[model samples]
Structures are given as structure tokens and as C-alpha cells.
Target: MLDMQRRKAMQKLALLGGGMALFPTLDAQAKMLEKDVPKWDEEYDAIVVGSGYAGTAAMLSMMDRGLKNVLMIDKMQYMGGNSSISGGSYAMSRTSIQKENGVMDDPEMHIKDTLKSGHNLNNPEMVRIMAYEGLDAFNWLVENGVKWKLFSRSGGHSAPRNHSVGVGSYITRPLQEQIIKRGGQQRTRIIMDELVYNDKGIVMGMKVREKYEFKFDRTFDENDNKTGKVKYYRANAGVIIATGGWAADPKVRQIFNPALTPDMPTTNHYGATGYTIEKLIKDDIDLIDMQYIQIMHVTSADEDSFGFGFRTITGGYSYGMMINPKTGRRFINEIADRRICSDAIFAMNEKGKNHPLLIMDVNGAKTVEIDALQRGIEAGAVYQFETLDEMITKFNVNKEAFLDELKKYNAYVKTGKDPEFGRTFFKYKDEYITIEKPPFFVTRPGPKIHHCMGGVRTTVDCEVFNKTGKIVEGLYACGEVTGGRHGYNRLGSNSVVDCIVFGRRAGFAIAERYQKMVRS
Candidate 1:
């Protein structure tokens, strides 16, 4: 029966052109075939197919480079795609914050840390650009009225250079406000529920369904089918695809990595589906590293409230430890980078049976903000216990084994050594806090589909490439839409910087091309 269904799906994909096989069902293909070719409703110098940090940065950079007419569109009703839902931390080096905090960091250090975290599979040129240009991008955010709360350390970085701005809105909101303030609102039009494309293997324009609503039902086959009045907007200069990754689509995720079944939860927004990628693939764009899907280690398993979304646990691995519920012992270093921790949890699952538990004391809880912890507790995503005994009894963990594990960890903390996993305490180092205080907190944090380290391959200049390694004219990509920046695994906080740095590159490149065309 499953084979029959698979055959039918393949046939339907063939009918609609094989590139779109990743769509939910054949109903979407039928809708596409039935839709009329829309007449151009408007034209612009450049059309950006997302409103996240990448798209916003691209549009703003184009405007700064004297390109007045640009259109930014998103399939969702609001702007700030997955970027707005992010932890609002950007990895940068040698910034004012780093200097103020008395931390010694530079782009060279950033580059080394990034390459090491990514296992050196990253493009050397792209890594250098992102690392070196990060400080400038940080200043750009500040110049545009975005403020950083402080500088802190994340898992992969060697220094306390992850600049935080509360949530993603701290940066996205300011960018939006600045766009509106600069009389660019007229030139910078944002149409919602629009999916742009390349026409006949060349950059052109987009097709949109205005005012369409997104039904949260994932099982609905016709969710992405065009419903409202369809319109097309033409672009004279080029089209920039910053439409993010395929983490949200189970079908596409499984197509890339078979182990990532539909049962796995994801931290991506609903719009993170790879519709744009499918469209680009149809245009002959090359996709690389599709199997390198990165999972985030902090996510809730509760399906009712904030399901699949991350809880803002402030202290991270520095203040807590991850324990195997079955053995009631620390199995992996909680402070390791996301991939290491996530892979460890996956390996320990033992035929996909159990999830690891992250436990912390009051001091660790204090590292996280009170409001965030309260929100998690109210949502029933986090649990608090008055004592170790209460926690052990509540979770049905082996009390003796759990206590022994905690005791062993505390001893290691006293000596500033994680002998078992070699967990580096980058921020606290010798002053690392012990998980001994009462009123302990615990949450089951499993891996969630987080990032795709692959997409339409691109050059360091943000120009998309074809399978033959030739540049696709008038087509640009950035952010998660482009591949080869962070080879196998992405370092924490580097994603935001990647979006901004390459976003500017794409913007400037497109603007320069547009000006040359005008001059000719």
C-alpha cells in the first residue's frame, strides 16, 4: 500500500515537473496547473522573496546603494520569518560590547571557532567574509536603531561574543521601523502570501495570492494551494531568494534525511517549507548538503502548548547538566555544541525509546530570566521541584543513581574539570557553579529540526549557481537559502550574522548589476 502511494506521488510530481515533488500532495500541483499566468501587476529593480533578517538586510543594503525601488514579500502574513522567533543572539567579534566586557576577541578567533564547529567543511572564503564583516554588521544594526542587551557565550564560541537583543524582534522590529521611517516605505513594498520565482531559468518576478490565510493544520494537503486572487510582480534587475529552509516540511525533510521522520518536532516557522527551493530547483539551481539538517537541543515535547518551539532557558549548559532518565546519569556534556549534544541524545535513545532530561538548580535558573522561566512553567513546559527527592520521585528516576551522578558532577565542578566529556566552560571557567542548591528545575529537551546547512548553492558574492557550476544570471541567495557557509554543523549565533553579512552582499551585488544595466 505504501509503495502504491509512493508511485502515485512520483507520477504526480512528474506531471507537475519533478522539482516540485516535495510538495505535500498532488492537489497543490493541480492548483498550480489550473492557475492562470498572472499579468505583471508592478515592477521593481529587485524583488526579495522573504522578510526575515536576510531579506530585510538585502533590501536595506540595496536602498543604501541607491536602488530606490525594491519589493520584499513573504508567504506569511507578518514579516520576520524564523528570524523573529530566534533567541536574538548574533555571533560577532571585536565589537563594542566585547571590548566593554573586557573580553579579547577578533575576527580571526571567530573564523577559527566557526570552522572548528562546522568541522572545517565550510567554504573558506565565505567563512572569512562572515567572520571579518560581522563587526561591521553589528555596527550596522546599531546604526539602524537596533540595540544589544549584552554579550554572552554560547556553546560553540571560544569567547563571550554572542550579542543578545532579547528576542529576534529586538532587531527585526527596529529594521522594520527604520524602513518605514526612511520614506522607503513607498519604494519598499511588502506583499504577504507571495511566492516569487525565476521565469524560464532567468531572474524575473513572483506570483502572489493576496490576503490569504494560513491554516495551522499540517495534515491538510491543500494548505499551500493558491486560493485568493493571483497577481504577478516583475523585477527588472533580479530576484533574491532568502526563503529559508525545509525544516518545517516533514515530507521534504524525510526526502533529504530519511532518519528525520514526520514524528520529529521542528523549531522552524510554518513558512519555512521549501516551496521557493522547489521552484528554484525547477529553474536548474544546484542544491548541496541537503542531508545536513542541524537539530537544536533545546525543545519541548509537549504537543498542546508551545509544541516544537524552544523554551528560553537562560543558563544553557554552563549552569545545568543533561541526564539520561534510564540510567539517571550524565551521558553527554551539556555545554557541547548543538550537534554534539543532539547526536549524543539520538545515540542514547536506544531504538528511539527515551528523551534526555536537562536539570538545573536555583542558581542555574537564575541565569535564565525570571519572566522566561515563569512563562515556561505556566505553559507546563518546565517543571520545578522543591528537593532532589521530589524530582526523582516525580520523574520516576532511580534516586540513588541520579544522586550519584549529581555528586560526581559537583566534584568535577569543584576541580573545574569535566573529565567525562571534556565540557569546556568558556564563560565561567574556574568559577563554574555547582548544581547543588535546592528547588531544582528539570525539563526533557529533545532535538528539534532546526537548520538546513544546504540549499541552492551560491558564491561568496551571494550569486546562485547551477549544477554545472555556472552562475545563474540575475539570481541571488542568502541566509539559510544558500548552502556552503557552515559545512556540516552551524555554530550557535553564527546564523544571524550569516544572514546579515551575506544579505548585504546579495543586496549590493544586485544593486551594482542593476546600475550597470541602467547605464547600458
Candidate 2:
């Protein structure tokens, strides 16, 4: 009898559209119309709204805490979001990798570097948590089969603390495999083309439209013909919005951070828009530092190939110097923090300068991995010249001025003092690489929209707060979706650690609350 009734209700929904409607029962529909409350279609113990590093970390933590009915979803067809395409460098201190590399680093040093790089606007407690717990997160990744063998130095770090898995799939793939191994396909249901929520939000459930391509800049309009059947998902415990930031959304980027216009290309994936952030704002969640977007200090001008266009030039910059082609002078210290270098480049561009050249010698090229350098060269991003005159003629740089600058830089390299710019080398300081050795390599690189240090404000443990400065019950956030971990800028390689640390905290917090509720 119940099956018959359900079939009849499904038939009614099919009549209304192609599939399920808002409410199945006529009485429930009447109640919804009278009270104007959203009706939930399905329920789970917990619902995670992304599948990136943060979302996967949160799910793993929840599963560890004995939460079996947890559901993870994503708007994209693939599981990994921006994390899959990321450079896969994670900032972790005092890890086994650091110890094996014979580098002495600690959480205090990590926190100091992070705070300094962020210009001291970072939340101290949150920074402390991430710094202290980062090593454990690294260990977690290793224990779960993430093979990390290399440790390199990025822009703002005090030591060689950045650990890389070569590619982001090293972190994401293991987590995905673990999820499938533990719970099978049904355990992690990733729904694509689903816009999770709208204005009416306590995160009780999410309104999902199947086969719909969501527009990030605007709210959903029912009149759109391309949209598919709408469904709702309820969270019995809480909802975790681990969706990334708005780096790729030009409209939102222009509105919030006007300095980053639509003309500038982004390193983020297509799905790294502000749709979730917009929905959270409509739900009255407190947003912080929306205007503080960080641009990558170096990227290739060519868009056709992959090597240097979207790839972060951190390693290149760390091992090379940025020179203004027209003046043939080093404009900024290439080893400074990401924001400072990007700002310096922007300042040069504001003065009507050409795209700055990142020039490196053979030894400097040796500082980076050989395979990576070869890939960039093969992709036509990195140009190699046999001599100074060849480089000058090819790039149309002033011959005399360029040679003069090179002489001055070589002098500094010998003396181990960069008095002009006070540039400090994080690695390879003992054996400095001068640009005099041929063949020479150069690339015109500049900043592109990289990271947005802004989103839903949350506590140290990742519980989201409202406009009234009170915790919104049954709601949590993690990863790039929540802000305050970074302030005006993020330190190099810190994002992955921030995601893992806080994502686990959020999962544990929600699971504890749910367990307490069950006991009561």
C-alpha cells in the first residue's frame, strides 16, 4: 500500500515536471504553501558539499569518528576540484620529510612566517592550530598512501618545509580510493550539476537541480529552460560547505576586488566560483576580507599550452630574478612573499612597463627539477639563448643596460649580499647561482588571479558564525570556502595544510555534536 502511494505521488511529480516535485503529498504541499517552509527530499547524518582536499579530509575524519551515514557531494562531475589541478605543495613543519631532508623547522617558525607573510592580519589562534597540527595532517596523508618524497622552499617560508606529492592527485587519489574501499560507491555519492541551496538557508537541506549549469553571478530563475528536475537533501547533523573561493568568477572578483579585473586570467579551475559564497551571504553568514584576492606572481602569457600558462612559477622565481626588459633592471626581490612580488609587478605595470622577465642561468635552472624545466621549455614557455647578446636581441632588451645589470648581480652573488633589493635566498644560499652561465633562459611572467583570502568567517574549529556573532547550529565550513585562516594574503604552500587541519576539526566537531544528540 505504501509503495502504491509513493508511486502515485511520483506520478504526480512526473506530471508537474520530469521527476520529483517540491512536495509529494497534497497535505504537505498545502502546509508548505501556508507556512512557506522548504520540504526536504532526503536526509543524511551529515552532508559535505565539495570533493576537494578539504571536503575529502572532512569525510575521512567523519568516517574515522564512526559516522557511517555521511554523504559527500560536488557540483562538478569529477571528484577532485581545484586541488587536483594544484601544484600539490603542502606547507608542513617538523614532518618526517623535513627531518629526512635535514631541515630543522617547527610550528612557531611556520606561524611566524605565515603571520608575517599575511601582514599580521591573520587570525592568531587559527594560524596556531594550522601550524601546530600540520605535521599530523602530513602524516595522515602519508599513512593513507600519499607518496611525498620531495621538500622544496616556496616564497614566504623560513625553511625548506614545503612537501610535494609531485601532482595533486597524489593527495586526492588516495583519499578517493580509501572512501571507495571503506563504503563502496554508495558511501560517497557525488552529484554533478546540482546547485545545493538558495536564500532560505539554515543548511537544513540543499535544493538541487539535475543537469543544470549554474550561473555564478546570479540567483536561479525558474524560467530558465536548460534547468532540470529539482531535488532536496537534508542533513540530520550538519552541512559542511567546502566549496572553494571566487578566483575564477570575474563578476564577483570585480565586485569585491576591483583591482583584479576580468581581463586577467586565473589559475583556478572553472568551478572555483562564488556561488556558495553568495548563497552563504544570503543566508546571513559573516564574510571577511572579500577584497583581499591574491594573484600568482608569475605565469606564462601563452594560453594554448599548459607548462607555464596556468602553472605557478614559484620554483622559477625562487631560483631566478625578475628583470624589467625596457630598463634592464631587477624590479623586485623575486624571493619575497607572493603578495609583495605580485604588488611589485602590478606597480611596474602601472608605470607602463613591459612584462617583467624571469631570467635564470644554468645553475639557477638546475635549482628547479630538470623534468619541470624541460616541460616548460618544450611547451614554449621558457626560452633558451646561448649568450647575453642573443637573449637581448631575441627579447628586444637594451643591450648595454642588461649587461650592466648582469654584472652588478654577479658581483652581489660573489659577495653573498644583495644590497640593492635585500633579496634573501631560502634555499641554495650556500652555492648562489649567477646569471652569467650560458645557455640563458627567460620568460615574460606576471601575476594572475591565484587565491582569494576571503569567504565565510569561522572559528578556530571551523564552526561558522552568523551576523549576530553567534554560531549557526548545524552549520560548519572548511577549506577555501571559510576565511580568516589567511588575512590579506596566504603564505606559500599553506593552503593544503589549512584545508586538512581545519577540515578534520570540522568533521570531528560535527560528529561529536551528532553523537551527543543521539545519546540525548
Candidate 3:
């Protein structure tokens, strides 16, 4: 019996030893203590470590490319992460919508706008791809049942190209439906503990924690987590890290940018602590653009994240304007990119002034969806008044100065020029929007950490690279988790495009590589 048991143990060891060859470098140190073969609880062709736009896109793309048995996992109990609550703005150029809307835009213009918004630090090649293929991504979503309408003008783009849904759910829900329809699997509450790399330094899979509970009350420390059951998941094709950025992790944010204090709120979800990227970095993966955290400068002051209060500001910035509470005057260009707006707001906060007042007229309010707009009003994040005088009384504005500023702003609208701040105002139905219409809307807008412009480095094909500048074979990344596309500041509405475009690339690349390997 002893001899038979020994033989069976050796046979099991022989069968499992090669599987535990993942992360050879890290395992070598552990092997010094004990040589234990990791047992895999699940196996799939592809594993996507997020459930947002990028991860969903990757799964859908993989399934579309005939790669079955793809699984998407999220640490959070609910899927969609920050994407579920996002504004659902997708920027694309040279689309049917643009042509139909008679908006003059091309790929060159899109690329130029992206680069300019990133302060010329963006990857030109990635920007080129995003611009050229944006229409395809847009069409893909539409074909996959995303009902997007109403092109709102975003701040840095020269033309109106921000195609939006009422909320982000409109985009994520339909794509999730398509993912299920295509036979992809999605599991929530599964957190990645460590990436499993084979002896050749190729990523093979991940060691994960099932039923993981994210600690939201404490500072998010990825290494100190205690909950969940340990399990290993093997991915034969590849592992795509679309785990998004570290905006919600105050500690991570302050490490890269000290100005991002702990008190500052983020638009990202609590689970967007960036543990997956942190694991990769600890395992010697290269990270880039770590200092460029982006902030949304026009969010409602009362709201914790981009929820409820955001709908009002979206329309306010598009059609109305922001004015300093004390001065009752526009400080920065209302149509400027996020960086400029955020810096201006931060400067105001430093001076001990309240968050700036964002006000829009009936014409601007027309841009907001009726239901959401009503909800914002009911939540008290948005205040509505029948007249500018009533708005002044409600918010205690400098009535005379505010009226004078509006007069000047309305003049600029009529002439299609903003000489004071160089704002590029939008024209609705051949007429530039002005705040002269009745029933004004106002919200106190402040800054919130919105996006992390820095993360793991990836090629144009979305293949993650190691610190040695060599490709970590079988490792892919896309969306906000991998940086290179946006330079210093990401343009509004561009993140959605980034996720879908690169996510599709990562998915297709993994599928093709796996198919080739099988054929070979």
C-alpha cells in the first residue's frame, strides 16, 4: 500500500509540476522553501480581468473571433466598475453620425484634437489608430445593440463628435447582453491575487480569490487583503488586464501625484483600486505616465462620485458656463479641456472659495435628458429657477456682475467667439447656444479625480511589455489599465473609444496567437 501510494503521488507530481511552472522567477524563491504544484480550479481559453468597456469588448471580440470559453472576472460584486456610472460619452470622427449631422471632421482632425488635448505627449500611432478606427468601434456598439443618440459637444474637440447615451448603462448593458449571447462567461467577486507566468516568462494564468470582498472603509491596500478562497485559473490563450486605473485609490494617486490628497474624491468605483496592475508592477512589469491623473472639474460639489449631480453639469458645460462664486465672472474657457478646468477649480479651492457655480439656461437644459434632469433637481444637486434673478437670490450671486458677465457671454455666442477665454462654443441648429432663455439651472461644480492617465505600458496591439522592454508573451492589456494613448490629459469622451478600440485589438490578438500556436 505504501509503495502504491508513493507511485501515485509521484505520478500526480509529474502531471502537475509543469503547470506550476508559472512565474518561475517568483516561484524560484518560494521553491527554496517548498515545491508545491498549484492546483487549478478552473481553466479557460482566455481570461479578462475586468468587466467594464475594455474587458467586455475583449470578451465579445474573442468570442466573435471564434474563441470559445472566454471568462471575464471582476472583484466587485457588481460588474461595470466605473463604466456603469460613466457619462457614456464616445468620441469618434468621420462616422455616419458626423456626416448626417453635417459636422466637418476627419481622422486627421480627430488625431490632431487628441494630441492637442494630451499636450502633444500622446502616442501618435495609438492616436492614429483610435482616430481611424473610431467609426468602426462606434458602429460595432451600434450593431451590438447600443442605442446611442444625441451628440453633445465635449470640451477639447474642435467639432461636436461626442455621441452619448443617457447614462453608461445604455452602452454596458447591451454589450454585456451580446457577450452572453456569444456564450462568454462573466463572474463577479473574483479578485486576481497574482499573475501566473510560465518558465519562458510567458503569462499563463492567474491565482485568484473567489468571493473576495473589497474593503471600502479602509485605505485600499491590495497586499493586505484577507477574505476569499484561493484558487488558480489557467488561461490557455492569454490573460487580458483591463482592470482600469487607480483613481479611486487615494494612496496610489498620492504616490504618483502628491497634490491628489486623500480628501479628494474620485469618479471611479471603490474596486478600481488597481490591484491587478499593482501585482504586475511588483512582478517587474513596466509602468508609464504615472504622474498624469486626470480630474473632472465640473462635477457637482455635493456628490461623491459621478452620479446624480453630473447630468446637470454635462449640459451646463456644453451649453452654459462656469463662473467664480465671488467674482461672478468666467475664469477659464468653459469649452477648455479637463486639465485647464481642473487646475482652475483647484486654484479656486486653494483660495478658500466655494466650488464655482455652473449655470445653464433653458437652451442649455434642453441638452439634458428630461428624466435625469428632473432626478438631479429632486436630489438637490441641481437648483432650478424661473429667472436669472431667482437664481441669483437662491445662490446669493452678485446680481449686477452676473448679469454683466452673461451679457458679455451672450455677445460672444452671437459672434461665435470667446475673446476673454478663447472658448469654442457649440452651435445647435446653426445657432450658437446662449443663456438668455428662461428657467435657468445652476449647480456648484468642484473637481473629482476622474481618470488615471498612467499605468502599465502596452504596444499598439495592446500587448503588455515587461520592464526589460520585451513582450511578456501571452499578456495583454487595454483600457485605462495600460497607458500610452493619452499623454498628460485625456480628452473627454475619448476613454470609451480607447477602451473599445484597444480592447478589441487585445482580444483579437490573443485569439489569433492561440490559433497559430495550435496550428503550429
Most accurate candidate by lDDT? 3
lDDT of 3 at 78: 89
TM-score of 2: 0.86
Could you tell which candidate, 1 or 3, scores higher by TM-score?
3
Which scores better on TM-score, 2 or 3? 3
- TM-score per prediction, in order, is 0.87, 0.86, 0.90
Clashing residue pairs in candidate 3, if any? 22-197, 23-197
lDDT of 1 at 178: 70
Predictions: Cα RMSD each: 7.4, 12.1, 11.5
- Best candidate per TM-score, number? 3
Q: List, residue by residue over 404-423, the lDDT tens digit for candidate 2.
A: 99898877777778999998
Extract clashing residue pairs from model 2.
none
lDDT of 2 at 18: 26
**Which lDDT tens digits does candidate 1 get at residues 322-359?**
78888899988787788888888888866446767788
What count of clashes does model 1 give? 0
